[model samples]
Each structure stands twice: as C-alpha cells, then as structure tokens.
Target: MSEKRPVMTWLTDMDGVLVREEDAIPGAAEFLRRLTESGCKFLVLTNNSIYTPRDLRARLAESGLDVPEENIWTSALATAQFLSDQRPRGSAYVVGEAGMTTALHEVGYVLTRSRPDYVVLGETRTYSFEAITTAIQLIVNGARFIATNPDSTGPSPAGPLPATGSVAALITRATGVEPYFVGKPNPLMMRNALNRIDAHSETTVMIGDRMDTDVVSGMEAGLRTVLVLTGSTTRDQVERFPYRPTRVVDSVADLVDDIVPPPPTESE
Candidate 1:
C-alpha cells in the first residue's frame, strides 16, 4: 500500500455530513470546531444551488455549526465561476432562485430573457412553467444550456422534489440541447473548489455522505474520500458501486477526533 500523506486540508459536504434537514448531525459541531482550532484549511461543499454561502452559513449556525460564509461553497457559485471563466460578462436567462441569480450577478452576468448567451438552470422550491418555457425557447434559438448541478431531485419536508436536472431534461427533450452541468460528480466542481481555498488535492481529504457525488468527485480530483451513512448513500449501497471510499463510518460523529492534529512528543 502507498504511504498515506498527512491530511492538511479538509473538504466536506454540508447536508447529511453536518446537518440533516434543519438538524445538526451528532459530532458535526465538534468536528468543525476541531478543524477550525487546528488551523486546517477547510470548506463545506454542497450541490444544492438554492442558497448562497451567506444564507447557508446562517442556516448552519441555526443547526449549531459555526461555519463562515467563505467556508461554504455551493454549486451556484461554481456555475457562476465557470461562466465567468468561459465567457466573461455573459448574459443568461436563469430559471432558478436568488442564490443562482446572485452568483451570476457577482460575476458580472446579466440576467435577461431576450436572446441570452446561455440558459442557466438551478434548484428552486417553486418551478415556474413560464420560466422553463422561456429557457426551452431560448435554447432552441441557439442559446447555450447550462445547469448548476445534475441532481434530479432535492429533499423537501414532504419528500423529494424535482430539481434543476429534472427541468434540464425537459428542456433537452424540447430543444435537443444537453445542458452542461457544473457540479458533482463532475470533477470540475471539485477542482474549482480546491482552487477556491488554494488547497492542494494531495494533502486534502474529502468527507461526504454520497458515494455517487461526493466520493466519486473527490476520488476523481485526487483527494482521499470518506463516506458517511447520514445522507443519500448507505453502507449496503457502497458495495453496489464499483469504486469505494477510503473509509466508511456511521456518520460525521466518527470523524471528530481525526480533524485534531496529534500532539508533538518530547523529541527534543
């Protein structure tokens, strides 16, 4: 076996790993505290494009985790960054919420319905039929298609709700244009996130709850991946996938001690 490099940076998924819905998972707060106090560079990643980092930070705080706004990364931000890099100051007809719109605005993108450069799709509680129709028409008229993530459904109090990818599929069927997804399991999201914190993948560890998105994406990005059974993926489900995580635990509660750096011995 190859020698394990000491982990110097940490990347973790927010939902399932830290908080499930509105409740904090056991040991999640302590894990964040230990990582912060240890002076380790870290970021909380999420594929949900419904909320901005500020919004998510406030939500996490309510769940008992003290995550700074900068420490949170969302698919909305990643998609915006991608658009900015590909076409600076581009225009888009967005079918999403404030998080998606805010990110594009920050990157100098114009939100319009008149022959936009791209049709951007993201998650929202309410999906407007009018907005989706506009996106389909624009795409058919030669506007490029883009999406924040490929997640087909998002969790809701009632149950799973249709998300960006589900709408993206509808538009694709109408226009024959496949939307470019900018989030996991696209490794681009992971790479962009690593650059966001100036952290190297070689010494970084990715903690996530889903093997399909988090674990696969992290593995492709050259980071060690740990799977926790608090979210989408389960212990029995792990073997069904061809690739495996570096380790599997019940939840984030099992990883609290690992974030703390070991004490130095009396080497002098």
Candidate 2:
C-alpha cells in the first residue's frame, strides 16, 4: 500500500471556518493556536474582498482570535497582484468599496476617477445603476474587465445578499465582455497564497466549506482538500456534488485533532 501523505500547510476559509457572521466558531482560536504551535503554516484565504488583511485581522480579533495580518489573504489582494503583474501602467476604475480600491493602490495600480484602463468589479452593498453604466462604458472603450470573485450570493445572518457575481453579470450583459476572475475555482488566488508562504502544491491542504470554489481549486492545484460543515456546504450537499474532498470534518476543531500529534510519553 502507498504511504499516506502528511499535510504540512493549510489554506482556510475565514467566514465559516473561523468565524460565522459576528461570532467565532467554537474552538477556532484554540485550533489555530495548536496548528501554529505544531509548526504548521496556514493562511486564511477568503473570496471576500470587502476587507483588507488588517481589517480582517481586526475583525477576527474582535471574535477572540488574534491572527496576524500577514497570515490572511483575500481575493481582492490576489486580483490586485494579478493585475499589477499582467497589466501595463493604467488606471483602475473600481466598482467596489474602499477595501478594493485600497488593495489595488497597495499593488501599485492607479485608481482613476474618469477614464480607466480597467473596470474591476466586486461586491458593493450600495451598488448603483450609474456605477454599472460607468463600468460598461469603460469596458466598451477597451478597458480590461476584472472581477474579484464569481460568488452569486453570500450567506449572512439575515439572509443571502447579491454578491459580486451578480454585479459582474450585469456588466457582462451590458458590455458583452466577461470579466477575468481572480477568486476561487481559478488557480490564481491559490497560487498567490502558496507563493506567499513559499509552499509547494503537494504540501498544502485547503480547508473550506464550499465545494465548487474551495475544494475544486485545491484539488486542481494538487493540494489535499478538507471540507467543513460550518459554512455554505453541508453533508447532504457534498453527496449531490460531483467533486469530493480528501477529508470531511464538522469544524476547525476537528481539523486540529486530525493534524496534531499526541503528547510524548514520560517513559519515552
């Protein structure tokens, strides 16, 4: 029989794996502590671009988890990095929030108030028709189209709210140009995270609640995938999905149990 592989690194989802809405999931903080103490590298990789790493860290800290800002990676950051490396010197017209704009600026991309080199789309709670029209105009005028993620809707304590994909769809319908996605299901985001940690594909494990984005991306990148039941995906939903994770657990606490070795015996 082939030897079982050991997972050396983890790519985790934030919203569900660590926190749910405004509350932290049970044992998430201790789980992280255990993983860190074990010398296992992990990054909180999320498709949500509404907040920067610092912002996310602060939010997580509010829920009693003190994670470093550098340990967090967002689709917004990945999108900015991809654009900075691929696109020429040009202005970015963002249809998102300050977080998205801040990410682009941090990546050395210029954000323009008028004509732009690209129309970057992301989730805006206050999406306006004027902003949509502006994006369409820019795309029609030969500006590149980019989207942070293709999530149609995001789950919330209240209910599901229209996500960035919905806005991207409207712009696509108007400009007839599909946006290049930098989020999950696209290997770009995961590759960026791996690069950040200086880890290889074989050593990484992706822990997330979504199958289509998280699990598929990890599998495609040749990483082990762990599906948790604390988010959008459920035990029943996995049966319906064609793709399957390498492992399944109820929460991040279970993940800690899977990876951590037991204490040494005194006799030894």
**Leading candidate by TM-score:** 1
lDDT of 2 by residue, 218-247 (tens): 988888888999988889889988789988
List TM-score per model, in order: 0.95, 0.93
Candidate no. 1 TM-score: 0.95
lDDT of 1 by residue, 148-248 (tens): 99899888899988988888889899999998999999989989999998988988889999888999999999999999998888799999999999999
Per-candidate Cα lDDT values, in order, are: 0.91, 0.86
For candidate 2, the lDDT comes to: 0.86
- RMSD of candidates 1 onward, in order: 2.9, 3.9
Model 1 bad stretches (over 4 Å): 261-268
- Give the clash count for model 1: 0
TM-score, cand. 2: 0.93
Alpha carbon deviation, residue 117, candidate 2 (Å): 1.9
Q: Worst ten-residue run, lDDT, model 2?
A: 256-265
